[model samples]
Target: MDSARPTPGLHEALAYLDSLRAGDLAPQADVPEDDEDASYDTLDALVDQQDAKPTLRPSPDEALTAIAIMRLCHAAESAGPDLLCPRPGLLSLLFVSSHEDRNRVARRHPDLWRRLSLPFPALMIEDPLGRVGAAKDFHARLAGRLLSGNGVLAIVSGMAQLPPELETLVTARATLPPITRRMLALILEYLHPGHDVDLPISENQLGKLAPVALAPVLAAETLDTALTQLRRLEDVARSPNGGPGLDDVYGQPEAVDALRQVVSDLDAWRAGTLPWREVTKSFLLTGPPGTGKTMLAEALARSAGITLVKTSYSDVQKAGHQGDALKALNAAAEQAKTGSPSVFFIDEIDSFYNRNQSSNGYILGMVNGLLTLIDALSATEGVVLVAATNDRARVDPAIVRPGRFDRHIRVGRPIRSGITAMLSAAVADVIPGPDLDRVSEQLVGLSGAEVTALLREARTAARKAGRDLALEDLQAAADRVQPQLGDALMRRIALHEAAHVVAGHAVGLPAATLARISPRGGEVVRPHLNAMTARDIKGMIAAVLAGREAEDIFFGDVTSGAGAGSNSDLAQATSLGIRAECAFAFGPSLSWISPDTPPTLLPTEVRNRVEARLQAGQEEARKIIVQHRGAVERIAAALLEHRELDGAALAGLLDGVEVQADGAVQHVGGHDA
Candidate 1:
């Protein structure tokens, strides 16, 4: 209703008007009247002659004037139509239409319209389903005639399906210049829906959006600025290598060397000065659990002044499609290329390279994808790959070849000195004494993780009681924990062990540590001899099993506790003795082909050989037991009385009670004498 309200097609109509005015050189034109006007007036008069005439009639001039007046009134009541005008050397508007009569001003200005170029330029028409077939035909005809130079033909439509020719034109390189920067910004905004336009787009953010486009831009930057920013981020992430140096990592000097080498290579590779002819871009860290593989990887990345992208196989496998998984991996790799050095850590890499026959092809495909990605990444500068695995043997051999993972570092259990230092560092606040030393000595074969668990237990015990951790707490914790081998097993183990010691002594092999059986921890049979012939080892094993078998044969039934025999004890003894004879080449009979070198021993053969040797040792062991039954009984009785006895107590009980080979005993000590 408002005259000031611009019609929907105002811009197009105005553009048309401007184009018409520019082309016409003539100035003005007056309104023309003729016989048609007179007829229209006459018809109007006739119609007025009778209010209800059989036929309606009006004077021609009057009728025409009335129609003109109605049109003018309608035009005045509604917002006037927009004028489409073209400006020379600028954009133009073509079509202008609206529902209002006021918008049809062009009909009154026929002369003006005739001179105007009708096909508009830089105007978009919504043509869903290409229904504007005639409109398009009209534009093509006009374009062939009056349209000059390069002009934008914008089409707005809900349906994006365009003719092949139009699509080709829209996407052509030459068409790019006519596309206004504003249009480009709009297209980008539309494509990336919901992205805040005003937010700062950093290298990190750009890398997230389209890493393919952003990675090269970042890589071209100066190294110092890139490294500094990355280091700052690392600090924020609280990464271990956030600081200037690598002094925080404990023990593992060899592992430290390997890490240093990796960092050095990564730096050189980034700087385009690597020395190795074919150095692997990736390193594999394999070891027992909790040996700091993950921590070391992070620290290595941090030290190189790179962002670390850690991913597990489980994360990739969850993506469903192999392509999707690879895309994720590649995206992560690209993200790390943000003008800085980056480490891409693939943890539990064995999962991706599982060599199990039952993996059903999925693993192979994953491995192939990873291999391709790794190869592509290796050729790239400023990116380092570090993979870790607990079971290195389970990984496919192809993944561990020379160039893929050139550096293989093994992290084993901590030795005695390492353990001691670890304890000193971890438990410095806790008071330690002879008990701690003794406990440490007993924990020789434990892995680093196990030792840490022990330490944690000790600390927890002390904390629960609201006191400083003491040696007693550690000792008590140790006592409560049983060894992998049980006590009854250990006694059979000890007698079996004592057999080894006795045989070793008889065979001129050095005696093992005094064979004292105790339930405190399993029978710890430490051979005093550093080395022995295969024959001597076999004799010792035979003796050990002989002791257990002798007790079984002589006593008819073995005891259940420590100092007797059980199924577990028999199994251990017999197995070891067989290994000594059949596997160790310690059997009495020697052949050109050593038993140790057998391709494979059938289970039946192994069982028969072990049984035969065990029976012989049992017979010999029974004779010895019979000769010293009194001394043996005395020791067993004393052990029952005290419920615990050291090596000295057992030795004292046997002192001066001489049992000769003739089975005669003479007491030479106080009570027995």
Candidate 2:
């Protein structure tokens, strides 16, 4: 062989020499006589003895040396004479992990491993756990100790669990030193040939290791296609129609209108010479789950003819580290910026503002970082920032305060007519039976998403049983989709709501148009009158208490159903009673009191007086139920049979007796008239 060529035997000999010095070589029992001139002869005799003992299983150290030699030979053979020469004088110290997968891969495809490991002195590390802190410390110490060289210092492990500090160094951002950046760039080039050696190394490790990491990047014609194939890679999904346009959204005309107005303003701002600040681009959408808040965000973007960048709590958390999360957030914003006239929607805004989250450094840093990003996005012109949360109260006030999120729109559950429209829209494709109205009536309290979910379930059932979507299918789906409030609980709920309806009618309050007792909950959709006198308020309070009172009368005890926390009927009644006592001064007290007036300063007798009023209301409610026992029983029986009753049907059951606003009952005809 030419002296210029590094022969495999010479490479192996050098490897064995290094291993011998490092104590990785196996011990020999035969010792040659002490003589400096005969040392080569002794080494040859030791090699012959090892060859004779080839049956011996290799030790960890021996196996490692063999792996290195195999990689060298495979690299030479595969690359031929054009082997990519290592940058002259560069000593890329790679911290090779003895992780099981890493070892297995190195052994199985030594050639591939060698090609990737080129130009780096692979140092086998015993750390299998791949702790980021330890890795960072190791990298920092090694970089300092080995900075006299010109090559890359790498920690090669199969595990992709990188800490934020190391990630920053890899990206060449944050506080990473210039020398470290140069070293990282060389490593990156080793991994990807033709990568710019001079350009700054800002590429994240996750992206660089995409081909070998747990999840690899998949190229596709469109983002939607990629998402369809690899759901894990998707962050923002293209809306079917700019994310279910207002027409596609089931309900909440008020919210849709507000979004439309904002879009119109955005258009004017974009077209005319008006200041960008004049346009309303940020909104806080508060709603319960399944209420289409996310859909609305997409719709707003679509309505404005803009792209939607949708990110969520789970997405950010999936990124693993604070640096990774910030990268994701920055990528989302950058995508929106590049695709101008875009909407950046952050779903579950409360996740970032949750006080309940642990004060762990990572979580706090992530939330603060996200807040800064949101504020920055608000300053941008073309991107509208719409964030959604199930409850606005859960989010920190600072996040939703003026200037950050200036507009607030509530996407509440669909009311009666809204439910009708939603059900109609959902079933537009199916041929329904005459009982569509019945289905709509039964599905009063469902959200737009719930409505669609039920329709999908019902459609599936209908198709499976070889039938078109029908009322029976819808009802069956409801029974399956809705929570199964046991027969006993459902009966109690029916009686409770029926009692409220009866008490309302008896006390000159309008009866509910539709009354339901579902597994999820119960509701009596009574007439929504704005103005109320003290008597009307008292009647309302009585109606609220009648549910519990009815349970008490029938079962001798009340369920927690009546004592729901905070926002329950009991709470509402108490609030109204207190308001009447203080704010409205409709109580027995002669003096009018402001709502802000301290209750402690109020005469101590006011509390007693308020309790008395509530007690009287309950008593009045009980008396009405007792007087109209037959009507109450009839309504309850009808409710148990039908699960719900329309106003017209309920009116016929009560013989046309209708409550008037003037606290009087009048005999009326059919409810339709």
Candidate 3:
């Protein structure tokens, strides 16, 4: 073969040889040809002889033959049966050696002399372009050969972008061999300009890839799936063609309205009617647990006809390498992008924000990356990002600020109407006469999730007994599932809650629901009466402190529900009280100074102040509970008998009680008279 004008086929063979050089078993320098050797001279003469054969107007079969020959020779040279190329027909024996060995042999002997060492002469072609042209022509012929049942051909391409020629080749008139068309659609969503693509993988795929990928990707995939499931549920929530509005949710008009606003914005954006900048694109659904924060997010995705991507914080954190995790996340986003107009949901976003001080700074970087991704997606078309968190207080405030997350909607527990709706819907099928009114009354302070669970329990009982569900079943279920606050606790809680009610009512704070206790954690539906002014909060603290002081005077020691270790309740009351005195100016001692103007309290100081106020409140709570011992017993007895009572029931029991001027009751440890 002419070195300067090696055939295109030869070049391909050489390139293949060069690739092997980088690996083991690379060929040594070409062995020098012996001019005196008659076999070598004869082979050289034959090679030069073929070069003059009018180039044989190369046919497609000839081209394929050349490629096949090159492949065989290359493989043989790399490793061997030590066989020389006797002729084109003998190339079949070359398969006995590995392809690498064949390539090595061809590299060592690039001329016809190597062939003369065999039994026969093999034709040689000199032109380079002719060789490429021949290769292309050979491929085309191979397409025909494949159609003629000589072999099989497989074409892989993006979804809906299959090559026309290949398609035609497969569908040709000739009897084609079994050919498989594999569609490998890869959708890359550009969440940010420089950010990697976010490929949304299904839950099943997620399970497969997460083990190999980084933590962030796993987190993103998990969140995406959860959100997607929620979205589907939301779609099922509505009547056909926007028929009737959803009636399952009740009482929280504010929450409902906020959700509606988000949905409206999402719809407008989807319809291409809203300005990109003005789109209510992102939201931070924050509130007490069991609220429909997660549900609402799903509902929004469903209504908008989008796939939801749910991610977990723990999964993201567990990703060993930051880059790996990021890549996984990007892949998921990209996957979601394939199905445009998708929702990317990240649950427990606080995990990323509240990285431990010991975390080797990876979390902070991840958070920044997430922020960038979210911001980018917000600006991009056809994608929505929704992050849900219960502990908004712990979330990095920067994330919830203007650009990252513009909408901060508090997803609080269901109100009376909401409870009624939730109960009615939950028990609609099982309860013969579903008294939502009664159920709602009994379910005071219960969350959406709790109500759902209650219904599920009732249904389970009915199924176990082999009977249809009845109100009795629900009531029985309710009996077994005690509220977070029991009778004993409620009596104490009643006095405690009563103090807040009376104090707030007395101080002209908004007249709202009286204190009612439940067994479930986070039962206080609306913890705050209103946005507390500095003065109002101060007065409330004084009342709490005074109640504690009164409790100490009347009962001697603090009660379980009223004193220390009541983390949730105490935290609430103390935090409020402290803020009132120190931050809100509700206390006389700290009213002169603007708490806002001062630097925020150190954690230690805040804890100290909270503890101090809690102690004071404990003393007052003891006195108040003791002074109203009769009323307390009445409420407690009622609670024990009924298992639960609404604010109205407790108030009715206290109707005959006389109040002292100091917001105290007259009776002590006696039955109501």
Candidate 4:
């Protein structure tokens, strides 16, 4: 056999077995004790009990392996006295318990067991465990039985460790034709009471869906059972405070619009005005942590007057195996479908797959199963599949494709006005005065959830001091609960943002606003320039670099605050600097270069010129700060006090301070020379 071809099936099965036996799961999960009573009735009763309680069962892989082994045994029986691969008799049952379980099974079905082993070979493998010599002898006998096509074997063990010869047998069996759909259906019929119920498994879907051995636990006499468990249909009517609606979701207009669009699509589909194919059901929500994605999802469902089916990674993992997880997913889909116009949500969808990397068998199975469930859900009208992730780039690309998760919506960080609104809504008892606006301004880049949490913490702080919610309480809590970049780091960040404001004023950059700087980071918002002259680009680059230059001038050394690489102001500055030099031919030579031209493609002299341009921009910013050192100090002082200042406020402060080259101070009438 070629060494290169991947045997993913074999590896997956092996991984599944290993997972069942790993860590705390081994003793507590799949293993049965050796001293258990030898009664098939007890074992059968236990199986029935487990079937009814899905939470207390082994993974679906065990049942899948058992079925595969049984199919292989049947194949050997049909081969009729000439099987190349080693095979057990017509009734070789791998019980995955102890020798006692095998004996009990034989006792339970005495007639069939006796007939199958009428002419029993000298030593058929009975127990999964025996002496090394006994195991060797059993394999030899098993080979002879396969040659003669007459014998019976039973393998029962709690240990997932397969004997070496048995492992080989399983590998060989993988080459055989898979079990037929008729055979699978028969197995399902024998296992459960309902004959008309739909199973999630099929030949086309076998790779995706696992046959859930514990599915009976979720079975409902009516579809409402599944709907009730997974989809909370009654939540719409049970809302408190004048009932929950879309208004509960704050700072996510785009997400709200998208959800409203989902409701519209559902309405259109139900009215037969929209084609089934045109129905937009699935959506992906992307944002940073604490952006109110979950609240948005719940509010969407609540506002639509429908149920919300919510599931998570931990919930699926608790299902124990592929089959059980698939069953859980199927159950959710079924419930969502049954509860028409419902929202089916998968929180932290990025957790389901390894991005651009090979995932283990369980994750692969989960990804495939979820994809299948999402596809199957299309037939069910008014069921919108919503998945949220903090990092969309970390999710599997296949999941977010057009037909799977058709729409992608973002829940962004809350702005000042949004934060103010959130604060106002959060505070009911105590009144916020002028400092409310100041606090809101300071919370520039916080998420909606974070804003709420900040207020909650503030209230708690105020209550501890036996006082009403005060501005000082809010300020202290904001500082305490905010993500800390350290006090020294905050000083550095303040200087950095202050430099941008001063540079923007000095260099005539348009509409530049210095937003708040928390311990986490800060932002400088500027109006989008429809077009940029070479001077404007250079000025912007200078403003971007002003932070680093300020640190160098004041602190004598710059931290990574300005240039922590990707997505940083320095990174943006460098990118724009390169574009100005190469792409736009804005360099001294005035020669048009390809926009895609890389820095490495530039002539050595041109590269030097690009570096010179960036340095000059940096020097220009330093000169402005030097000329307006008094203004710089004033702006930085005000920023430290308020945590933020708009472009207009900054311009006002700078306009009031004037510095001559001779260091004489005078008041100026207008902002920026």
Candidate 5:
């Protein structure tokens, strides 16, 4: 046998064209037929009968097509035996990137192309000019090979620009994903049969090279050295160039610590020292907006010496059509999985719904697709998945369930210590003994993004004035971002927040994480009540309404702080009451309303029960406030003087407010006395 490879069949196709010109080509109806060459009416018939695996000795174009099949089908070859590749004619489209890539897969239907192991085919659109032409007879010849009976694979590079008549043949369409590091390794290994070849370079580095880059690897004297140099250059390019890492992240000690452990595990894994399953590669971050979920992911990626690819459900859905959006989502998932030592940061992940018959089919498809992608991603060795959502309740349970996301980390607003550290870092030039303790207290409840925004404005102010950023400038900037409330209003805000702390504690709720007064309103960020029983639900409602009750008791009135917005105290209390009556069967009827039903749409009986529940909660809050009046006053005064309270100090303050289950004013053991 000659060692030379066979023509990619395009040449044979041309020869057949030449045969046609010389009047030697037989008509299709008159051609000889056999089981191997007989036309199958359906692709299923071909798939069911043919079990031919791809040829062991595949040309570069065939290898490229294999990678294309994997991408288009979203199938990873690393997934073992049972993972079947699609049959030949089922691969309707084959997308490739550039002219060189186009040349590799175009005009050539190799034996391997005839048996594609992919469910979906890729579609890459380009103008194939002279290589393919608009000649009247040439059209007939090209279509003959493409639409042939015995399965011809159409590798689409210039399929889009094909004459309308030819383009119509493509019933479905798709775009090609980039050549991943794993794909590159496969191509090299396929080329050098029996050799263990692994590229030490990242997908970013691999993507910079076309399929043609393999020529050098196949020709190189030392395979390892070439790969080492390529990786070394990229490592240098990716060096710590003053970018933020986990060390730079301030506040949220638990989140930082958890991420640091993950980074350590990833490092050990990369060093080939850690067991595969020992790494917890995925975690869900739940917190209010701007708590730095994305920032933490970025820092974690930097610490791990990997790239961070940030995307969201909202971003993927921007592709318009459900099919296109799903394609975009698949592409994003493949991008991260292929690029190992990477963090796939998906924000607003809750936007993708859990499977519900009531929801549109599009959402169900997206949710199903996301779950599959996440499963593949979580199982992949080097990928660290960081998914964030503000409302954890809205997230599909399956997506956030243990294995899919290893754990949940609540990235709350920074406390006093975290705030101090953030302020100190922001003005590094300031003397260590400066008043950051006070500065931190003043900005305690603000989100990290809000703080960063104020700091940026301060720096900009200094820059515009041609001066260094002073402590005064920082304070001035904070004032500008949120103008300080009047003394009376400040006191009221402090009282409002302190009441929430005291009421929650009195009702035996968990310790509040933070309590602060801001210009917009006051906040007492408590651990979720996780209220289970009817009484627990009612107690939580009391705590929700305590701010209003405190205002009513102390100032003989209430502010809009507890009522104005949809997220206000009144809204929450009402919601809890509605849930108790309408959904949870905690009230009158055993029947329930549909999920996500608005309160206004509720029946008068249910609405009345909800109102009655609210009234009872108000009475409960009033009793707590009246009993702890002195402690409430003192804590409020302290909050006004200090601007915020948390940790040991806040715990001490709340601990002194003694609780008597029967509504009696009890004495403090040692503190309040």
Candidate 6:
């Protein structure tokens, strides 16, 4: 082995080399063995995150040997005190930032006590449960030690979890420096002379195994085989506890397809067949909650076979002050970079609202820090950063430009098939009694989160009633999540959705993008028509009110659904009309009025002009609806049968209809899909 890279502990390595030349490097300090707390039962009893059976941890003796090997390798470097080792004036109030089992402090070996000059029986408390138990016996034990003038080391996952009663007694807080590759390489060389120690593992991977376990991993017949074993160990330690991969996710095929392509690209890049810049590395998952935005990040990481460091801006701020928060934020960035071929996900990015509200230093620091990290990670080759927000409009513009998040993927509520799959999975263990396809149609308006919650409600009832979950329990829960609308309303929604598609196409829309309806409600993704021309404005206005016009023409009256919310058909039509008149100067009046201005405050003349445009659009929509009655009926029938008609399917169903946006007829089936 080339001895050029001596690592940080050169003194220790040289002494060991001299001992090889002379004799043995006798173990320093006759440190007594203290393996009482290292017992298997104690480690088992500490905490079980999963309700299921816990995985087997290293044996007490195995852990001690690993620790001893690590100390010997980095003898001089690790001689200083850490959180778990306290002597007199040092090692007070050390905060461990990670909740991973590998990052948590293990039972201290005998040499650790001698090195730190600590008591023979050291006492340390790490509250993985945080402050919830602060008022319990924990506070009593900590306070007693402080009052007695005895040394104590208290560790917490976060500073906020530290009760105010003992805040004054705190000296400092920090996270332990993890084991690094340099140390491991030297350990390998020391274990087997002339052995190649230039391994590919990173510091983050080595941090998982306790010091004592390295002998077994490095002692494999060959270094290649040893590496293979270490990879399996790292995978187990870093797994998101068996999270679902891209294939396991049921819906959002567009997002899934995009992620799968990136996964392929990642494989190609690693194989030297694709350029790193061509890879789509950054993403923004924007949509309603319970739509599995975070789950998508998890799936992407699992599908790509990489690590995922999930965090949020709030998570960083929880570290304490602005300085510490920035440190924590930087640490997350470093972890992502070091753990290359990694996915770094930050949730609730909308909270970084535009920097105009930078009233305090903390908010500014966080936003600036995040932007810096995003910029740095975007330039990185194998790292992918995925950010999620329930409210996309609330996010700042600068943070979401083309260079930052290359794709803005929308994760809407699952379609009928996705809902059916979810329902089937929830009750897979129970007796299968219900036709979930029909039930999924009725529950189409519910979000994935709502479906999970309702199922949980059903499980509770089944457990209370002392019987397997039955069709009645599921139906009862489904009703609570989304009440079943009768057949009459269901047909009406189908017609409402179908009319938008038919009218939009008749008015020369690029195409009907999406048409979906449930028994309770429905939605249609309006054709994306900008105000590039007055004709475009007129087309959008007509399509917006087509649903209302269809209802009025068929039923001789209109339901309040059209005018229900700010995003309703009537509201959208009014908005387009206002923009046409005031913003676009396409209407009779050239007067400009802010859309945010309430209708009551608008000038009488401007309001009249806007009202006139709306009336004309509604009349045009009525004409188109009447002309496309056959097209509307055919599509509506399909929606009732399938609960959804989107993309090429909806387009193919409208192939026979011929209309033009210029008020002229055309036979082309061209679309912007």
For residues 1-673, write the lDDT of model 3, one tens digit per residue. Answer: 1133322234443333233333422223232465211111233223332332332122222222233345444434443433333222221112111122223223333332232234322212111111213323433543453444432221111111123554443321111010000000011011112333333322222211111122232123343543354344333323213312323356556545665665666556533366547766677777666777667666665554446677766665565577656555544554444334456778878877643222547777777757655665665444567787877646766776667776666665666556666666666665543465665666766777877788899889999999988887888777666534454444444444444444433334333233444454212222333244544444445455543443444346556444445344554566665565565544445433333232344445544665666565555444545555566456545544443444566457666444434432212211000
Q: Cα lDDT for residue 529, model 1? A: 30
Candidate 1's residue-wise lDDT over 34-135, tens digit each? 422111122322323232222222222212222223332233223222213323322222211110111122222332233333433333332222122433
TM-score of each: 0.40, 0.44, 0.49, 0.45, 0.65, 0.63
Q: Is candidate 2 or candidate 3 better by lDDT?
A: 2
Across 267-292, the per-residue lDDT of candidate 6 in tens digits comes to 67654467778998888887777888
Candidate with maximal lDDT? 6
CA displacement after TM-score superposition, residue 216 of candidate 5 (Å): 10
Ranking by TM-score, best first?
A: 5, 6, 3, 4, 2, 1
**What number of clashing residue pairs does each candidate have, in the order they appear?**
37, 0, 68, 2, 3, 3
Instruction: Return the TM-score for candidate 6, rounded to 2 decimals.
Output: 0.63
Least well predicted 10-residue stretch by lDDT in candidate 2: 171-180
| Model 1 Cα shift for residue 391 (angstroms) | 3.0
Give candidate 5's error at residue 281 in angstroms: 2.1
Q: Which parts of model 5 are misplaced by more than 4 Å?
A: 1-242, 354-358, 430-433, 529-531, 656-673
Which portions of model 1 miss their true places by more than 4 Å? 1-251, 264-281, 302-305, 335-340, 353-359, 429-437, 480-673
Kindly give the stretch of ten consecutive residues in candidate 6 with the minimal lDDT sum: 664-673
Question: Least accurate stretch of 10 residues (summed lDDT) in model 5?
Answer: 664-673
| Clashing residue pairs found in predicted model 4 | 96-157, 97-157
Per-prediction RMSD in angstroms?
A: 27.0, 19.1, 22.3, 18.2, 12.6, 13.2
Model 2 over residues 418-451: C-alpha lDDT tens digits? 6667677767466353456666656656788888
Candidate 6 clashes between residue pairs 3 or more apart in a chain or in different chains: 66-211, 66-212, 67-212
